[model samples]
Structure formats: structure tokens, C-alpha cells
Target chain A: MQTTQRPAVSEAVAKSRKKRELIKNVVAYSFIAPNFVGFAVFTLVPMVMAVALAFLSWDGSTNNPITFVGIQNFIDLFQDAKFRQALINTVAYAVITVPLTMAASLGLAILLNQQIRARNFFRTMMFFPYVASMVAVTAVWNMLFNPAMGPVNMILSGLGVENLPRWSVDNNWFICMGTVILFSIWKFMGYYMIIYLAGLQGVNPDLYEAAALDGASPWQRFWYVTLPQLRPTTFFVTVMLTIQCFKVYDIFLMITNFGPGGKTRVLVGNIYEAAFTSRKFGYSSAIAMVLFVLVLIVTLVQFRGEKSMNE
Target chain B: MKEKSGITGGRIAVYVILILLSVLTIIPFAWMLSASLKLNKDVFAWPMEWIPSNPQWANYINIWTKIPLLKYIGNTAILTVVVTLLQLLTSSFAAYAFAKLRFWGRNLLFLGYIATIAMPWQVYMVPQFMMMSGMGLNDKLIAMVCLQAFSAFGVFLMKQFYDGIPDELCEAARIDGLSEYGIWAKIMLPLSKPSLATLTIFTFVNTWNDFLGPLLYLHTDSKKTLQLGLRMFIGQYSAEYGLIMAASVVALIPVLIVFLALQKYFVQGIASSGLKG
Candidate 1:
């Protein structure tokens, strides 16, 4: 009877412990429920809908039923000339802006890292553009890019340069892309510079001191020591800048409005015009799918790079 | 003496280059200010007026009266504040679960959240609009707020901070018979103030300056945000450079104030996020 009673007591204790564990799980899940639910409803569900919508035709109206068109949306998108232009423009923008911004920011970071007067002030001023409203900054750039009476052209002609391109309004695609890239580099470099500055803080100072003690010139020290030390930061900045450049929309919208005849259209801008202007929800989703693939590839590459670095 | 002179030359060169770059960076802003104070005709004057001979303070007043600038600003402020607070609440709660909780499928859920961080909004714009409209949330401020409130990036950021904290603290609180909610509210929230501040600034700025979200969701002029309002103002009054610049300046003031007040946190937030610009 005593042995049976002992077994019953142990069983009760084990059962209570299991109940407590279940209760703890409930509490933990309850804490996550609100946010996770919202995320699922808003983001996750919509993402799934986007992928599905790419294969279906919908005019984005309540009356029109979503029709399954299979691969026709993507097939049409591939053949569209404007989509091709947007693809090229987006790639061009990324190709030009990412490296330029990276180089400029890294340069500024190195300069700021030096023993300089009013370093914080310089850093803040450089970063001011990043925090400013894009609408406002692009509006100002619009005025600056004014062909006839703009300061840019005025300064260029003052330097005795003849036949200046109309900057943002230039019919040439490269010129239009260049204007957008210039604005991007100006706006984004400061933020990257701050990242590089933080990266610089992590680099062991003793290495630099040792390089100097080895009679290494400043340039050699920078090339041999600083560059290798900053490889991780450089990689991170490159990936981020590439991703942002692909999504470039607002500046082109405000500055060039696709440049004379839709010359400066980008992937995001194309999606916006397709969905909002044309009201072709299916077609826009197809374009978005292309963008999604591009970004996913870049992100995957970054993750693989990070994993290797960690190893 | 030669080495000291060489150092002085290098220092001078650095100062010169930095100052030159700073001036170049500031040129557009300075031109905006000057143009905001000039008359419409004088705004595009040749040689570009670095200073307005006669300042037109009335452009600011005109922006207010010509359009619903104040109302747009109010809408933006309300949306920004609400969205920022909601993101902080949701993100911190979700982050706590991801960081401290020992539950089934925890790592899997976190990985799902991380996967979405790189997914651009363009991918879901059309579908999200449809979903919002289906839920009768289109053209509503609540739509924008709800859409932005749950950010994977925000969760990831706060989780990184939370992970740095020792689990022993939470265990100790649990041993004291405190509930998980109690531990979160009492122990977690108090310790993660810096991360909270960083997310607050980031969400506020992003929401405030957001153009595409407002453009898609808020169709009515009355519900328009500052960025959308500024865009509309530019569309209607592109030729009126003075008034446009004045409106842009007015729109920029709040962001500048927030940035100036919390510049440190902004930098920290970006650095910690590792990918945010």
C-alpha cells in the first residue's frame, strides 16, 4: 500500500510539471500572438497572394473576378519594351551608384577617422542629407537640374564647357541615369560612411601602429592593413547599396519623371505605373516577381558570404 | 622641422578636402533656402541668387493657405507617432519571444522573420493593396498604421539587442514566481530602452518621409501625408519654385528637429541594423 501510494504521488508530481510546461508554452505564444498575427495577416498572406496573383489576371476592381492566366502575364512582361528599359535602367543605376557611393563613403570615413578638427560636425553635415525628406531633397535637385537657368549648367558653362546635357531632362538615357546616380551617391554616402566609421572603430589599432613601425608609408599601411580589415564592412555596404539602388523610385519620379519619354524608368517605378496607372495588378505582380528574384539572389549571396566569414 | 611641416601640410590638405566636400554637400540645401525666400521670377535668375535680395516671407504663408499643408502635416504626425509606437510594442514583444522563450518552432519562426527582411515592398504592393481594400481598410490611416506596425527588420533589430542580455536575469525573475509577461514588462522593457529609442526614431523617420505607402493607401487629399501633399503641391505648382521650396522647407522642419534631437540614436540604429540606410 505504501509503495502504491508513492507511485501515485510521483505520477501526480510529473503530471503537474507537464501542466506547468504547457502553461509556460501558452504564455510564451500569447506574447508573440499579436505581432505574429498582424505580420501574418498583412505581410505573409499578402506575399503569398502576390505570388499567386502573378499567374492571374485582375484589374484590381471588386467587380472583376481574378482570372487564372497561367504564364501569360510573365510572357507579356518579358516582351514589353518598357519593362526591358526599366530592367536596363535599374541595373545601370545599381551598377553605377553602388560602387561610387561605397567608394565615396569609405573615403569620407577614412578622412573622418583621422585626427581632424570638428569631426562630429563634418560627420553630421555629411549625414544631414540622409535624414532629410526625399521629396524635399529631390525637389531641390529638380531646381538645381533645371537646364537653362539651373546652377549646375551655369557653373558648367562658367567653366567654359560648351553644349551641356540637360542634366535630368536630357533625352539621353545615360545622362538621365547619371543624374539619378549623382543624387543617390550624394544622399546615401553619409549613411554608409557612418557604417564604415563604426567598422573602423573595430579594426585593431595595434596593427596600424605595427605597420607604421615597419616603416610602411601611409598609403601602404592603408592599402595593406586598413583595406583588408574593412573587407567585411565593404561587402555589407555593397550588398545594401545594391539592393537600394534596385528599388530607386522616388528620385526618378520627382527629378525626371522617367526622363522625357520614360527613359529613366526603374523596376519599382514600373510596378507602380503598371498597378496604379494601368491598373493591371497581374502584370505588376509579374514585374515585382522579377525584382523579387533579383533581390533574393543578392541577399542569398550576402548570406553565403556572411556564413563563410563566420566560419 | 621637416617632418613637422610635412604633417602640417597633410593636415591642411585634409581640412581643405573635407571643407570642400561639406560645402558641396550643403549647396543644394543652401539653394533651397535661398529659393524659398526669393520671388517666383527671381528663383531662376541667371548666376543663381545665393542670397535673395528681398526675402519673400509670404511664400510660407501662401503654402499654408493655397493647399491643406497644415492638415497634411497633422496626418503625417499622427500616423508617424501611432506607427512608431505600435512598431515598438509589436517588435519588442515579438523580439522577447524570439530571444528568451524556450518553445517549439522558435528558431524556425525567427528564420521566417529573417527571410522577409530582404523582401522588398514592391513584391507585395499590389496584393497588399487588394488585401487592404478587401478588409475595407483602403484609403484609411489605420491601413497604413497596420501595414507598417509589424516590421521583420524591427523584430530582428530588437532581437539582436535582447540576445545580448543574459538569460540568467530572466531565469532569476522566473524563479521569483514572476510570470513571463511580468518578466517582459518588468525586466525586458526596462533594460531595452536604447533599442526601443533606436527603433522609435527609425520607424518615425521612415513613416514620416514615406511617399509610396501614402500614395497607394491614402487617396483623399484630406488624408494625404506630408510627402504626398508636397508631391501634389509640386505637381500643381511646379512653376512656382518659391512656394514649392517654401512648402518643402516647411515639410522638412519636423524631420530636422527629430534628427537633431536624436542624432546619436539614429547613428546607433543604423549601425546596429547593419543594412538600414
Candidate 2:
């Protein structure tokens, strides 16, 4: 009788444990439901719709239905001159802005990491532009870049320079692009400097002492010891800056208003115009798809690089 | 004595360079403030008045009168507060499930969510705009609030914070017969104040400075946020540098205050998330 009761009691315990596990699952699901549902409705669904809409021709009007035209939108995008220009402009912006900003911020970080006075104040001053709104920053920059009456040109002309290009108004793409790049560097350098500062903290002081004992000059120490140690941080900054550079819309929109006849038009600006201004939903999605692919490739490369670095 | 002199010289050079750069960094803001107080005609004066002789304090007042500055500020405030609170609640709840709960497809769901961060908004901008308009939510602050409230980045941030916490506490609480929601509210939320504060600072600053989101969603003049209002203000009063600078300065105050007050958390939040990425 005792042996029979033991098996029955064990069975009852297992069943109760199963019931508890089921209840726990329900509670977990309930905790996740609210956020997950909102994310699905807003982000996940829209992403899927974007991919689908890229292949269809739609005017975004309810009177017309989305018609599937495979590969045509992509083909047309390649053939479009404006799209080509935008792609080139965006690449140029990233190419110029990324390395310059990185070098500038890394330089600032190295200086601040020294036994300097008023370090915190310097850091705050550098970061102030980043904290300010893009609209406000660009507004100030726009006035500074004002062709005739702006202080920037005034300073140049005061210094007896010949023929100041109308800064942002210059039809020459290079000058306009340069203005945008300058503003981008000014706006973002502080934020990147903070990242480098954090990276600097992780470097062991003993390594510096060892280098000093080996009769390394400050320049050599930076070149040999500091730069190598900052590889991971540099890589992270490069990836982030690259991604951000590709999505450079707000500055262009506010600073130059597409820069004196679309000379500085970027991929995002193109996509904005196509979708909202021109009402070509399908075509705009195709441009966005190209952007999506470019970003995806960059991100995947970074991940692969990170994995190999880890190995 | 030679080494000491060399070190002193190097230090002096560093200070000079730093001071110079700091001046360059600050001059734009200084110029903005100075120009905001100057007469419209004096704004472009060459050797530009670093200091306005007669500060036009009325430019500040004029900006208020020219546009519905108060209305825009109110709109921005409402969106920032609502969105920040909702994001914290939703992100923390989802983060608790991801960090503490046992579930199927958890890792897969999280990967899907995090992957969205890599995609720029341009990818889904049109579709999301269409979705919002279809629901007749376009031009409404609540729509913007709802759209921004569930950030995958916020979830990822909170989850990283939650991952630092030991499971022993949650297990102990469970043994004490506390429900999962009770554990989340009473145990997890209380302990994760630092992460919450970091997320709050980031969300508030991002929302306050946001231009594209407001530009896309809120079309009506009365519904515009501060960023959008400033943009339109520039377009209309492009010639009025004094008023523009004053408006810009006014628009920048809240973010500046937040940054100054919470400098440590703000910098830490940026560094940690950035390095992790």
C-alpha cells in the first residue's frame, strides 16, 4: 500500500509543476504583449510593406491600385540622372565627413585626456552644438554662410581674399558640399570625442609608463601605443559615422534647402521628394531599397569585421 | 630643470591650442546670442559686433508675437513627456520578459527587433506615413507619440541594463509568491533607475530636437513642434536675423538645461550605447 501511494503522490507533484510552468508562460506573454504589439504595428509591418511596395507601381491615391512591375523600378533608378547624382553626393559626403570628423574628435580626445586645466569645460563647449537642435544649428550656420552680409564671407573679404564663392549658394557642387561637410564636422565632433574619451579610459596607464621607459617620445607613444589600443573604438566610430553620413538629410534640408538647385541633393532628399513631392510611392520605395541595401552591406561588413577582430 | 621647462612649454602649447579651438567652437553660439540682441541692420556688420551696444531684448518678445511660440512649445512638451513615459514603461516591460522570463522564440524576436535599428527611417517612411494617414492620425501629436513610444533601441537598452541584474533576486521574489508584473514593478524597476534615467535623457533630447518626424506628421500650423516652428520661422523671416537668432536661442533652452543638469548620465548613455554598437 505504501509503494502504490508513493507513485500516485509523485504523479500529482509532476502534474502541478506542469501547471505552474504553463501559468508562467502566460504571464511572460502578457508582459511582452503590449510593446511587441506596438512594435509590430508600427515598425515591423511598415518594413514589410516598404519591401512589397518597392516592386509595385502606386501613385499613393486610393483611386489607383498598386500594380506589380518587377525590376522596372530598379532599372529606372539606375537610368535616372538625378538618382545617380544623389548617390554620388551621398558617397562624397560620407567619404569626406567620416575621416575628418574621426581625426578631429580623436585629436580633441587625446588633448582632453592630458593633465590639462578646465578639461570639463572644454569638453562641454565642444559638445554644446550637438546638444542644440539641428534646426537651430543650421539656422546659425545659414546666417554665417550668408553670401554677402554673413560674417564668414565678411571675414574672408576683410582678409583681402579674391572672389569669395557664395558659400552655400555656389553652383559649384564642391563648395556647397564643403559647407555641408564643415557644418557636419562642427556639429558632431564633440559627440565622437566623448566616445574616444571613454575608449581612452580603457587603456592601461602602465603601458604608457612602459613606453616611457623604452624612451618613446610623446608622438611615438601616440603612434605606436595609443593608436593600436584604440582600434576597437576607432572601428566602432567608423561604422557609426558611416551609417550616419548616409542618412544626412536634416542638415541638407535646413542648411542649404537642397543647395542652390539640387547640387547637394542626397539619397534621402531624393527619396523625400519622390514620395511626398512627386507622389511616386513605388519609385521612392525603390530608391529606399537601394539605400537599405547599401546600409545593410556596410552593417554586415562591420559585424564580420567585429567577429574577425574578436577571433 | 631642462625637463621641467620642456614639460611646461608643452603644457602651454596644449592650452593655447585648446583655448583656440574652444573659442572657435563657442563663437557660433556667441555670435547667435550677440546677433539676437542687435538691430536687424547691424546683424551683418563686418568685423561683426562681438557685443551688441544696445541689446534688443524685444527681439525675444517679437518672436513670441510673430508666431505661436507658446503653442509650439506646448505641443513639443506634451509629445516629449508622453512618449518618454510610454517608452520607459513599454521598454522595461518587454525588457523584463526578454531578460527574466522563459519563453519560446525569444532570441529570434529580439534579433528581429534589433535589426530594425540598422534600417534608416527612409526605408519605411512612406509606408508608415501612409499607415498613419489611413488611420487619420496624421497632423496629430498623439500619433507622433504613439509612433515613437515603442522603440526597439529602447528595448535593447533596457535589456542590456536588465542583463546586468542577477536572476537570483527574481527567483527569490518568485519563491515569495510575487507575480511577474509585481516583480517587474516592485523589484526590477526600482533597481534600474540609472538605466531609466539614461533612457529618459536620450528620449527627451531626441524628441525635443527631432525635425523630420514632426515635419512628416504634423502639417497644421497649430500642431507644429518647436523644431518645425523654428524651421518655418527661418523660411518666413529669413531676413530678420535678430528675430531668427532669438527664436533659435529660445528653442535651444530646454535641451541645454537637460544636458547641463544630467551631464553624467547623458554622456554615459551615449558612450555605452555607441561603443556597444
Candidate 3:
């Protein structure tokens, strides 16, 4: 802002604004240099490398012959039973969890936005699960879902609901979805609720005041005014959540770790097993490519949706 | 007067529900705390013991002796601090450039930054592993440290904060002879403290909780992060409830403290940034 004095700030500093612009350009490049380089190597470049590796057949072993087997690995995924299970579970996981998670967070944000006493206390309580190491927190969740000693089954029995479906039990499709969905909500509701709360607060109270003058009931005001005003925030949230649910690994890896006949398995889980367990780096890259393609499609749809809304 | 009383009644209902829901949310940890203090067998008694029989505080001490609890704590603290400092510096500079100092490729690069969000880290893990392995930095903490040191998400947040500072304030500084970098470090940064504090807290919390990067990169126990260090406690000598809970509780304190202390900024930061499309 003080650039005006620079009309004569220094002997070397004098010149047209273009000269000054060039100086600023160099400075800005230095500032963002590390980040662009990091993104290129770790993100952009590795992705391209992964794409190239997809067609190569090698087990990452010294003696294994490498061959360019175009379309073979992609074809293999169609017949791979484990890959099918992982794909199905990933789809089911997102379908069940994302909507439920968003709804719960939105509800909690509304409740918390009210003039409740000890609001900060409630906020902290809700956000506690989100602040810990996922492994540690999921270990607790693991015990909670344990068939033998977990509190869930214990609570079920206390209510005389005997013969409860075993959570974390192998091949129990319903229970796998249930446990992962519950854990996913508990893990993230705080963070998202915080986001929703901000959105709720951003909504001008003037609208509420106007509705009150018109004799609108609280529920009517909320449904008519608050909900419509929060659409933009909701759209941003939906996009972010969709991407996150797709990439979810830490919690999935920790709780059940693709458990019980691989019923809870996800694409990332399959990739981990392929690369680390089987030492098939090329195959893992192919799985990653599939995941990349899926995410690309999902994000592009959201971008298109956003553009249509803007228009 | 009837309407006033009805409003009062509704407020009371809200309070009761909020408190009840809060308890349901927090009860698991309370149960964890209770179980952590109980003797091994007391954990599974059918009727259940809500509190520990003896309140064995030594469970906290036992985790230290039985597991590498102290080493894990040290590793987590160092990693959290180092990464937070680096991200704040790198992010702030880039964000300032994006927010105020315009140049060529600026808008395009920002779009590229936003686009990185969709390419989940797994898509690049194989290639990242290749590069780090090539550099011989795989086993070292550098692998984890460098991966996170400059983040696109961090830049996204910092740029938002910078956008809020009036351009006139910056122009005034420029008229007074401040360099673009100097204006950022001086006028802009001090004004952007609230957002910087939020970024600092999140970077620390996320880094501390991060399990994937440390899991992928660090192999040796001595070099292990707290998350990896904590993973060791689960299976060793059966699932001892007391020791594991002790370690888990201890592990949560730092992040919890960090969150509580700077909470106002964290909430405000998210609120501002969460402003939608």
C-alpha cells in the first residue's frame, strides 16, 4: 500500500509500474514455488506416473518380467472378485453415510445455534471425537463394535434384544454398513456441524426479524427463510463431503480394516492390500487409476451442478 | 402473555434435549475413562460396572512401562509443531500473493490448487512412493514432513483470509514505500492474525491425528510417530483395556488443549471459509 512513496523510494526502485510489476512477479513466484513443486512431484506428476504404471505387468519383484499389457489390468478388475467386493462396499458406504452425516450435522447445527445455555460446552463435547488420532479413536470404536464385549451388543442385550447382529463380524453386509456409517458420522459430525453452524450464523438475523413481524411461526421461518438462505453453504458442503467420503481411508483402515469377507472393503483398502500385502505395485496403480477416474467423474458433476446453479 | 409462556416452554425443551444429546455423544469417552481405570476382568462383568472398582490410576503408568508411550508423545509433539510452522509460513506467503499481488498465471494456478482437492492422495501414493524411494527419503521423517509442508488446502484458507483485508489498506502501505513482501509480512499478516491462528490450530490437530502418512513412511519404532506408536499398544499382550485407555487419554490431551485454547478463532475461521458457492 505504501508503494506511492516508492516514486522515489530508492535509486534502483525508480521505473515504470511494469518494472515494479516484474519485481512483484518474481517475488510471488518465490513465494508459491515450493507449493507448486510439491504439488507437481507428490500430486500431479505421481498421478501421471501411476497412470503409466497401470498397463505395466510387474509384481515389484526383482526377477519378475515387466510387460506392457494394455487394457489387461482394467479388464482384470471386472473379473476380480475382491475388487468387485471393494467397489460395491465403497459405493454402499458413500450412499448410506453421506446423506445421513449431512442431515445429522445440519440438525445439530440448528439446535446448537439456539440460545442454549452452556453452548460452548455442548460444542466441545460434540467435537471431541474429531480431535483425536483416528487409530486411537477407532480402537475405541472397534471395542464398541466387538461382538463379545462391546457396549453396543451389551446395550442391545440389556433391552432384551437378544441374538443381536454381530458388528465387525465377517460377511455381515448390514452390520458392516451400519458400523462404518455410525463411525463415519461420529468421526466427522463435529467438523461439518461447525461448518453448518457458521452458515446458519452467516444468515442475516434481519430475515428472521422480518418473518417474525409477518407472524411467521418459528418452524415456518426456518423452513421458508433459513433453509433457502443456507443453500449455497449446503452446496459447498455437499461437494466437499462427496469428495471426502470417496477418499476416506484412515477411519476405514482403522475400524475393521476391510473386515469380514472384505464386506467393508473400499477402493483405497484394495489398493493398500495390492501394493503392500501382495507387493503388486503395477496392479495397485491400476486400482488407483480406477479410483481417480471415479473421483474425477463425481467432482466434474458437482462442478457442472455449481455452474448451472450460478447461471 | 400466553405466547411468551409457550416460548419459555420451548426453550426449556431445547435445553433438555441438548443436554441429553450431549451426554449420548460424550458417554463413549466417559465409558472409556471408566473402563480404563477398571481391572482387566471388571471390564466385561455382564451387569457392567459404571465405575472402576479400585480407580487404578496406575493404568496411566503401566502404559508407559508396557508401551513406548513417552516416545510416541515426543514424536507427535515434534511433528505437529514442525509441520504447523512450515505450513503457516508457506501458506501465508502464497495466500498473500494470490489475495493482493496480481501477476501472470495467478488465476490459473489458483484453479489448479482447487483442482488438487479431488485427486485423493491414494491416486498418487504409488508415484509419491516412487519419488521418495528414489530420493532415499522414504524411511526418514522428511517423507512425511515434506508431503505436508506446503498444502493446497492451507493456501485456499489463507487466501480467503487475505481477501478480507481491504485493498486500500494495502495500497496505503504501498504508497508509503513498502515492498509487496514487506506489506504482507507487516500490514497484512498482523491484520490476518485470527485466520493464521485458526490455520495453526488445524495444522497441529490434523498433523497429530494423521495416521496415513506416518503409516506409509515411517517403519522403525524409534522413528515412529505417536499414531503409529499408539498402534503398537493395541495387540501387545492381549487388549488390555486399562493401559490402552490410559495411552489414548494421554494422546488426546495435547490436541484437545490446542483446540480449546484457540477455539474462537477455529470456529470463526471455518465459519468464514465455509461461505458457499
Candidate 4:
């Protein structure tokens, strides 16, 4: 709104309004100060520093002075075999886990959406793994997947399977990566299932009735009505899962710890290993920059997709 | 009659499949519990003893003795409570400003929060660790508390809920000469209970389960949380599967109780805000 200083009385009213606006601003800032201050210190500053640190050389020690080495870390990172492998592993884990989690969660949501007995019980049970601590959850799975003596192999042997793939102990990358992906799917699918259940509920029942009236079968109704209605939810889930998969460290740490020769090491695990274990702050920040850019691109795409959908 | 009977059969079949899937979902945790009770050798006995003839009640006792499990739990509890309480207060307070108050740069500031929420902490954890270490907060539980005390996601979640609140309520409260803080405290806070519960659950669960934060910040044995403690226990006593499972069970009970008690909030919160811990 444009303020016109037409005359003395009008000028006085505008001045008072401006004063009120100032008071409001002060009050708002007072409310926001506490969280914003902590946020700025802990999260915002570190984020900026991370970007800056990526272009510098620092061993994260007091003796070594930080030096500007623009793009050198990136050059070194690209040529590093461990970084390359971690990048591939991270991408592979995300690529495999995201779609599978989405599908399984969607299917589970559809199943639970039916007017069945003890719906909440089933929902709670499914979502239980997500709430459980990753350390505990992975510990249990480690025992279950313990190749030489775990129940998984024991059951497999009982089912007339001669060759067990030696679950986590196997040197094969596929076995390790596959187990990680499967665990990822199980742990996360329930959370997505809840989101999808919400989406499924928002779907108009009238659409199903209309489809049925038009001679559509159950699968057809689901394919034609349910899937389309869930596009936004699915989009949200995919973006969340993608972002999550990239940051997956706890599961890998507990289950594999980049072991069996770093076959299952992820981007975050690499960043951790580099920064903490190797004390290569600059190189690690460079790796972090790659993660940041990947997530930023996904987020930008999400915003764009959301805007288009809203339009 | 035929169609009706077929519908019954279909319903029964769906029920059966759901029951089976539920069992499949629970098998791992059930196995954990079962293994926690069993002797290590019997835990993986052929055909898998679903129930041990004699439960190893001693393994549970050994966990507390072998490692400082109680201290880890105490550390985790303190951190979780403090972080959750602080997050709720600050995030809700900040959210009220973002949602209800008209101010310069309000939209831009809220956008900052949204942007950070999308950026995973892994991207900046190294710098964060460096900053904390530079401040002489290394190997301190206070560092983890400070790091997690403020959250963009919590603010975003609360703001979304607050945005739904009728402006007229605040206006009426203002007419009654209630200060903005009073309006937030007496009105907004009370009204945003569901969101508060949601944030509490997320913060509590996340803090309790957090591994990397403790792994990075809290290096001392005395300050380690349950996740770090359990991991260390595993590394040290890799052969003692029974004790490990027992400790894992102890670690899981708090979260399981929290989840089961207030699970509706989990679904409602996620459905409304689409945020997760």
C-alpha cells in the first residue's frame, strides 16, 4: 500500500500507523528471537561454514591453518576411489529403496484402508519398526541375519535351500547391499504407509462408487481413482524418501558399518569417516557439498512440481 | 445368496492375509524378545525355538552390570526430555510469530526455516562439529542438547497448525486487552495441544534414538546415550548375543510405550503436517 502525505491530518494517521507497525515488528521479533538465535548458531551458521569450508583446506587440527584451495577438494574427491564408491552406494541405496518403500507402503495403506477388524492394531504393528530405535532394531536383525547361526538361514535350510548367500558375512556386494536395501524398506515403509493412509482417506468415496457403477472392477477403481488421487502424497513420499535415503547412516552403521570392504557405505557414512576418523574436514565438507546440492536439486524440483500441481 | 456368500469368503480371505502380514511385520521384534529370553545357542536352534524352554532372566541382569546401561539410559532420558521441552517451547513460540503476527521479513524468515528443514544435517555436520569443538563443547551432552534444542521442522509443523486457527480468536483476545504473549499462552498454546503432542513425540523419539549426534559429540563413556552405549556393548561383547538382545529390549521399551500410548498423534500429526522425525 502506498501512503500519500496529502495533508496534516492524513500525515498524522500515517505516522501512527507506522508506529503501530514498528511495535508489531518488535513484538514479533521478540517471539522469534529464542529459536532463531539457536537456529542461527547451530544450523544456519554451520551450513554457511560448510559451504565455505568446502573451498578451503583444513585438517581440523589446531596446528594446521585453514587455507583457501578452491575446487581442489572437489578434484581430489572425484578421483578418490572411496568417495566414488560411497557416491555409487548412496545413489544405489536411494534408487532401490525409495521406489520399493513407496510401493509397499501404498499397498499396505490400501490393504489397511479396508474396513477390517482391528485396523489400528495392524497399523500400529506396521509403524512399530519406525518408532523403534535403529540400534535395537538393527541388532535384532543382525542376529536374525547372522549367516552361520541366524534363524533366517536356519529357516532357509529347512525349506530345502542348499546354498545360503551368507547374509551379512558374504563378501559379495549384492548380498550386503540387498540386505541393507531390504532393511531400509522395512523400517521406512510403515511411516510412508501412514502418510498414504491419510491420502487414501482424503480420496472421495464417491469416485469409487461412480467407478463401480460404470462397471469398473476393484483393481480398475484403484488404478483409475486411487492412484491419481494419491499423486500428491506419492510425490511427497518420494521426495521425503529420497532425502532420507541420502542421509541413511544409522542403519548402515549398526548393520554393516561400511564393512565387508565398504560395499554398503553411504554418503553420510563417507562424510563421517572422512571428517571424524580421517580428520579431513575440508574434503568431508566437499562431500557434504555434493550431498547438499543433490538434496537442493530434489527440493527445487519438489517446489516446482508442487507449484505446477497447484496451478 | 451366492454373491453374498462369495463376499463373505473374500472378506475372510482379506482378513487372513492381513493377519499373516501383521505376523510377518512382528516376527523380527518377537524374535528379539524371544532371543532376549533364550540362551545364545538355543536362540538359533534348527527349526528355530520360537520359545525357549528356560528364559535367560540372568542376561537382563548382566546387561546392567556389564555396561553402564543405567547411566546411558539416564543420559538419554535427560537429553530427550530437555530437547523435547525446549523444542516445544521455542518452536511453538517462534511458530506463533510466523503464523499470527504481521511483521517485516516474516515470510522471508519462515522461508529460511522451510529451506533448512529440507537440507539434511549431514551436509553441514562437519562444520557443526568443528564449531562445537571450537567452543570447547566437545564430548559434552550439553552440546547435543544445544544442537537439537531448536528445529525448523518443529516450527514449520506448529506454524501449519497455528495457521488453521481463526484470527478472530486472537482479535477477540486482543480486544480483551490480552497481550500477545497472553494470547499465545492462554489461547494458542492450549489450542495447539495436538501439534504439541506431535512435536513432543518427534523430538522425544528422535533424541532417544539419535546415534550420530552422540557418536560425534559425547565421547566420554559417562555421557554416552543408549544408542552409543548399545553399539559399544555390541562391539565389546559381540559373542554375548543374549545380553545384547536383552539390552536392546530395555532400550526399546520406553519408545514402545510412548508409541503405543500416543500413536494416534503420530498418524494425525503426519497426516496433517507431513513431517517425521
TM-score-best of 1 and 3? 1
Candidate 1, residues B29-110, lDDT tens digits: the string is 8999999999989998886667777899999889899999889999999999999988999889989989999887788888
DockQ of each: 0.73, 0.78, 0.64, 0.76
**On a 0 to 100 scale, what is the lDDT of residue A206 in model 2?**
93
What are the lDDT figures for the candidates, one per model?
Answer: 0.89, 0.90, 0.81, 0.90
**Pairs clashing within candidate 1:** none
Clashes of 1: 0
What does candidate 2's lDDT look like per residue over A1-311, in tens digits?
99999999999999999898888788888888889998999999989988998899988899999899998999999999999989999999999999999999999999999988899999999998888899988888988889888888888888898899787889888898899999999999999999999999889899999999999999999999999999999999998898899988998888777868777889999989999999999899999988888899889988998998899
lDDT of 3 by residue, B1-277 (tens): 9999998999998888888888878877887787788777776667777876688898877888887777877877887788889889888888888888878999999998888765788787866886788788877877887877777888899888788788999899889998887897888788888989989988988888887788888898878888888876675654687677777788778887888899888888777776643
Q: Which model scores highest in DockQ?
A: 2
Writing each residue's lDDT as its tens digit, candidate 1 over A33-106 gives 88899888899999999899899998977798989999999999979999999999899889888989999999
- lDDT for residue A287 in candidate 1, whole number 0-100: 96
By summed lDDT, which 10 consecutive residues of candidate 4 chain A come out lowest? Answer: A1-10
The DockQ assigned to candidate 3 is 0.64
Question: For residues A62-179, what per-residue lDDT tens digits would candidate 4 score against the true structure?
Answer: 8889999989999999999988999999999899899999999999999899998899999999999898999888988888898888878887888899979776657898898888
* Predicted structure 4: clash tally: 0
**Per-candidate TM vs. native?**
0.97, 0.97, 0.92, 0.97
Candidate 2, pairs of clashing residues: none
Model 3 Cα shift for residue A41 (angstroms)? 2.6
Candidate 2 residue-wise lDDT, B1-277, digit = tens: 9999999999999999999999999888998999999888999887767888888999999998899999999999999999999999999999999999988778888998889987787778888999988999988898888688989989989998899999999999989999888999999999998889889988999899989999899989999999999899889878899999999999989998988888888788878777888
